[model samples]
Target: MRQQERLGLILDRLAKHGTVSVLDLTTELSASPASIRRDLKALEDQQLLKRTHGGAVAAEVIYELPMRYRTGRHQEEKNRIAQAAARLVTDSVHSVGLGGGTTTTELARALGSVGRSLKVVTNALNIAGDLSVRSAIDLVVTGGSVRPESYELVGPIADRALAGIHLDLVFLGVDGIDATGGISTHDEVEAQTDHCLMQTATRVVVLADSSKVGNRAFTRIAPIEEVAMLITDSAAGAPDLERLRAAGVEVITV
Candidate 1:
């Protein structure tokens, strides 16, 4: 594999398992230990992982989501899904809960355009800022420690804040979803926070594009049934859609 791809795989493994030993990367990538060490060193230099005694551990702090990167991938599809998701929010949606991810970020923007006179609750600092200035919307940012990568507040403080609030709807974004693993992500802390968000909200809606479907990620956040609605682009294939439908998930395509 190319060095970049190999490093991505190493990061994925570390994110999933918490650590990646030299021998582990060597075996997984079919590379020499020296090559894997070099790759690890490069990743360490980028601050994506920390070098341990025998392997590398993922960095505790995630980098903030860059607008350039977020805007490029699945831009059109995310727009479609965002439009469809916006239609679900009516005058009855008094309270809103937002999660972290590129999709949910877009959903926040969509909500800003259509949702007026609403109480918005979110752990995402960016989303809070996005809706904060709007006169028609009352924004409530969940209290917690900030995770720099996603600009999200997570941990006990956020969890406690979530426990106290009851939302009419919660919008979630995910890294991957599979029948076996349900919904999953790259970070364990975010997964735990997402689980709490699911529980605290009256109705949970997951906003993901077609790419996330049927893909098993490192950390399982919530089961399929926990989501009352799965909103995605029209490209979600037949088999995955069928699987989601069979599992009693309300699937909505934009």
Candidate 2:
């Protein structure tokens, strides 16, 4: 596997098991022990994990992986979800809001390719960068402090920027979504900013891969009822889908 792919897998395993042994990673990643050690060291330098004698452990306060590392995970599923979401941005939808995440980033690219005139508002540095160059997109980027891990801008400044603006639809990328805990993310500040974006839109659609479905993250963005629809991969469990639908969210498995 490529280094980026290896690094992503290592962190994913650490997140699930809380610790990973060099032997296990070497076997699972099909890489040399030295290569695995190097990967561990690289993550340690980023403070993403703590290097152990023969392995690594999760950081004291585990935050979401940076966007670059997360891009390769569930990539195919994200692309499918993005395409399905793009269909919702019909000509009648003049203005749209996009939240930060890998899946939403893909949606931005899909929108650009559709060659439709749109007033796009976003708080993601990466998404803004991508859409800014598209002539058909009148891009509006909110002002706020940047969160490196997710490439999202959050805090009071962003909230103020969203205050009076209105959107026909908004696509939010969340860290987790569940029937009870509702929609959530890893950072409380980002969750608050995301909530502010939702308030500006008449319709709210959440984009999440199956892994995020049925899970609850650190901060709640809003209750499930606040969402109009959820687009996820078919890998999501049937029971979870039923629960989400029962909570008044139209769940779509792409």
Candidate 3:
């Protein structure tokens, strides 16, 4: 496997099992012991995990993996979802809000590709950085403390920045979306900041992969009724989609 794919697999194993022995990784990944150790060393260098004598353990915060390591997972699905979400930005939408996540990052790229003039508001440092070079986009990045895990700016400062702003539409990237629990993320502070963004927008469209469809994270952003629509991949389970639709959320499977 390629290095990125191997890194993703190692991180995935650590996230699920909390620790991984080099021998086990070599066996599972079909890589040599030396290669596995090198991968472990690289992850440790990034502070993604702590290396032991013969294995690696989860980092200080592992519930939410760093954004850099998450880019490879469900990439194709995210791109397709992003394209479908971009289609929702009609001529009427001049100002848009984008929440931070791997999928929303793809949406940012999709929006830029369309070459439509828009005023974009966001707290994601990476997304802001990507859109800043686009002349067609008037980027407004909120001031707040950055969370390294998700590259999101959150807390009182972010909430304050979003207070008076109004958005025509907001596409939120969530870690989890459930029929009863609604939309949620791993961090409570991030959830609060995201909720603030949602409150400012007339329409809220959640962008999530199939894996997030039926999951519930640590904190809830809002109830299902609060969101206007959900744009997810077709791989999402029918039962969950039906439940979300029953809760009055417009479900669009790309």
Candidate 4:
């Protein structure tokens, strides 16, 4: 097939599956691994996708874009952050809360492989769905109206469901996270739900990439004090890292 046609097919797969491995592409396209890598590299150069350690995801921009537009960017870093965050969940832990967005969603994916049964409470429809099928995870979704862009179920139903439960840990994803300004996300209703999740969890560990480390988004989720720890990639700026450290929050950089 032509390179243009191959690139289009790869992106289509990414859009459909949320991820595409090089091995799968090699099989599907009946092409060499070298050829598949080249195609991924080409799409990455165009900023159409972000090449991961094994494959690619939809490329995301710097703005508060939709989930499809922002899931693939800095994926490698996000994976590392997810790994570090997942390490916090031990066998003693029972319930966990997950907020919406790519980073938290990645964390949910990581939890699926952990050899322990966990009760997961989440307002994000995608995250809940990801864990729902895993026998190791006893999933409790805060059922409510689903938001199209992020696939998070916010509003009264979700908040009310979480209100009755206390969680061991909470992993949150946000558009921007500033040391002084605190953690912030895009939508107001989602922000409100995030607050409820935070209040319900004993320890809140936020999963965010370096891009969101010092930036400020539309709505505030909580202040810096609300967070127990922050997990991010090495690409995070030293200035913001130092500021967060000074705030007495344990900042883990992978």
Deviation in Å, model 3, residue 137 alpha carbon = 0.6
Candidate 2 residues 1-254, lDDT tens each? 89998999889888889999999998998999999999999999999999999999999987678888897899999999999999999979999999999999999999998788999999999999999889999999998999998999999999999999999999999989999999999899999999999999999999999999999999999999899999999999999999999999999999
Cα misplacement distance, residue 53 of candidate 4 (Å): 35
Clashing pairs in 4: none
lDDT score, candidate 4: 0.85
Clashes of each: 2, 0, 0, 0
TM-score of each: 0.74, 0.94, 0.89, 0.75
Give one digit per residue, the lDDT tens place, for model 3 in 43-65.
Answer: 98888899999999999865567
TM-score, prediction 4 = 0.75
lDDT value, residue 227 of candidate 4: 92
If both were scored by TM-score, which would come out higher, candidate 3 or candidate 4? 3
**Candidate with maximal lDDT:** 2
Total clashing pairs in model 1: 2
Between candidates 2 and 3, the lDDT winner:
2
**TM-score: the better of candidates 2 and 4:** 2
Candidate 3 TM-score to native? 0.89
> Each prediction's Cα lDDT score?
0.82, 0.95, 0.92, 0.85
> What RMSD, rounded to one decimal, does every model reach?
7.7, 1.6, 2.5, 8.2
Q: Which pairs clash (backbone N, Cα, C closer than 3 Å) in model 2?
A: none
Candidate 4 lDDT over residue span 55-100, tens digit each: 9888765223457546666778998999898889987888899998
